[model samples]
Target: MDFENFLKKLKEKDRVTLSKVITLVDNETKEGVEFLKKFYKERKDSFRIGITGPPGVGKSTLLNKLIERFAKKYDSVSVVAVDPSSPFTGGAILGDRLRMENIYKFDNVYMRSVASRGSLGGLSSSTENILQVLEIFGTDVIFVETVGVGQSELDVMEITDLVIVTLVPESGDSIQAMKAGIMEIGDIFVINKSDREDAYRVSEYVKSILQMKYQDKELTPPVINVSAKNDTNIDELVSRIENLKEIFIQKGIIERKREIRRKKEVREILRDMFIKSIDRELKIIENKNDKDVSPYEISEKILKNIDFKSLEDIWKER
Candidate 1:
């Protein structure tokens, strides 16, 4: 369908329309880009949770568990699961939600699987756009589950009100999570697969590290052990997550973090605009026989009036 019709229907609170619009956004077409612009204009704070860890850390299972528990409390929830993108096909595999069978059918649950597109940032531009779209729809909680962890998951770290780093006892994440940067990424931590041995050890390890690191800070991250497959401690986990949400608000850091995220979003938008203008300049050069200037030539001309050699510096960096 046309963009106008899609927008009209999506704005009317129809799930089917929003689902179609989400597919469009997933494709990242020109219409999809426009839809995102309209989508973000209505954006507000949605309860965003990032569940991330290395592969096979029970992220999907934990996500499914959280969906069941959270859906009971929230009126509506949106989930964005990031999967590996095909290097050749230029699309995401979208496999992260294959295990989230039950939540997909709930009218209150909307989940979309996104391909990572090999972006080092962990989140593609479209992933960020989709999260904002969920917020626009007024979802009570928006969960973003990343396939792998590390610095890339840090992208979600900036945007979410709470970050849950999920891991099993034997995965060595107990040690990995203590890395200075990793510890800072989570507001709360989850030791999934709690039925396994050393789950409490992992929890104790996290706590000891938190005490050492935050010797002066007011709040330290909380760790919970839960078995996603067996549904053990799921309700308590949900309640703890809800509690952290208020702690974040009380500290006033969440709003500050979001302000920085907004700044980065604006910078990306401006960068995209400038890149498109350069592409347009190149196209004009390609079509014209003699007089039209290449993007480099146009850049030189634009920079000539300024004495700082801006284009020259940019070229040097490239």
Candidate 2:
């Protein structure tokens, strides 16, 4: 692909070109890395929100409502829905797009589905790269909907400006909601399907837990009850999101988060590059049919041959 032409077309707001560039980036092609290295500095400011929860929690329905509201309010809105990948084929059904088919009619709304590819974090490994590409494409708001997650899948908190944890009346008892991993990561707790009889009770229970957890902190995560199917209290939820975003901006929280994210991204990139450079050595070690050699001894041998000073200098130059 001619990256120069692609960039030009991207500036023209060509959705086709935008999709092509995203595919290139998502696949982590050499051209994609080059394109990012050339233009990542030009990324526009955008708010990233993560929606995550266990299965059958109405996350997609809630996200669809949020997108509709954001699309009307913002100049441009984008979504990345991470779906579970098939273990055998490594392909995803991409069903979130079908659930949110109505939003496609808006010219300002763009959505993409990505396979989680066995990432334990509930997000795709390329999620941050895709978000950056969308930022460069001029989005005002970006929403990332993660695959159905268990308790420890909290990686979304690292990359998003804020995380909304969606739940339903049938999710679990108050004891289940008090778990440390998923509960600790939420900036906002949403009870979808609020029309159900137990929805209010669940919301109140969550609020009490949050109050105790954040009593000393300046900001406490709010629990809101909304029925996505009935379109209940969605406007209020949107208002709360906007309000929290303002506070985050004013407190420089978003900037701090992005700085941390950038540092981690650099480390990850260096690790990946270093591993690829040692692929041949790793293969040679693997092919050795020695039954007596321990894995630790093999690793030590590999480490002995690597020049740390040279690698450090190379990294500094970059």
Instruction: Give the best candidate by TM-score.
Output: 2
Clashing pairs in 1: none
The stretch of ten residues in a row with the least summed lDDT in candidate 2 is 309-318
- What would the per-residue lDDT of candidate 1 be over residues 1-318, giving only the tens digit for each residue? 476676666667678888777766666666667777655667668888888877888888888888887787788888888776667777655776678975866778888777778575377767777777677677889998885455566787876777888767985564664466666777777888989988898788877877876754546777888998999998888888877788778888778878888898889866765564455445645665756547577668644554334434543343
Whole-model lDDT for model 1 versus the true structure?
0.74
Candidate 1 regions with alpha-carbon error over 4 angstroms: 1-8, 38-41, 88-91, 173-178, 216-218, 278-318
Residue ranges of candidate 2 with Cα displaced over 4 Å: 148-152, 174-178, 216-218, 307-318
Q: What is the lDDT of residue 211 in candidate 2?
A: 88
For each of the candidates, the C-alpha root-mean-square deviation to the true structure, in angstroms, is 6.0, 2.9
